[model samples]
Target: MHATEALRRLLEHCPELDRTHDLVRQFASMLDARDAAPLPDWLDHLAVSRLPALDGLAKAIREDQHAVVQGITTPFNSGVNEGRITDLKLQKRIMAGRAGVPLLRHRVILMAGLRRSYP
Candidate 1:
């Protein structure tokens, strides 16, 4: 049988997997909808579900619940900040040991914020 068919049969027999699947879907929907209000209920269920595999995930979300909520609700993200950090790190490594602070700074200033020519 196909993998999906096997999983379907297994899920029919495994109530735990069924519950986990439903909970995961609800969590995914909450993320897509940026709805934080339902997070506590979901976490509560996850905690009592006793799924040892997901303990770390639960812990992280609990520790950063506020940030998680903000992340879900806010349109702002760290993409730009991460990109700039990457660019700066790359430029610094390239210029390392060859230049002093001023030249390194100049090179970083010149290289960053510009698109690479791929010709």
Candidate 2:
């Protein structure tokens, strides 16, 4: 089926989904514009949306609302640090009980070098 036809049929059957789609689009617009001004209103709408999953999400985000707003407004992120940590964890798991610290250190250094060279 075509995408629009399928979507139209879905909205016909589950009207609440239209609200969900609108809320999602609003949030995406906020992100694209790097604006958190409308976030509180968005949270309020989500909290009363009567959708259990989205309500839970709204609660969780409210708990860390400051961090979420900061993430939206700032260009700085932990992506590089997170990638490095993931690389280290994967290497540790791969070499578990099979190698010593020296080998692990060598592998980590090589991985960092490769990442820098490629990226």
Which candidate leads in TM-score? 2
What is the C-alpha lDDT profile of model 1 across 7-99, one tens digit per residue?
Answer: 899989998898888889988888799888999888888878878765667777999899989987888889767876787778777767667
lDDT of 2 by residue, 1-119 (tens): 99999998898889689889889999999989999999999999999999988899999999999999998888888989999899889999998868788998899999999999998
Report lDDT (CA) for all predictions. Answer: 0.80, 0.92
After superposition, which runs of candidate 2 have C-alpha atoms over 4 Å from their true positions? 79-119
Highest lDDT against the true fold, candidate: 2
TM-score of 1: 0.56
Clashing pairs in 1: none
Error of 2 at 97 (Å): 12
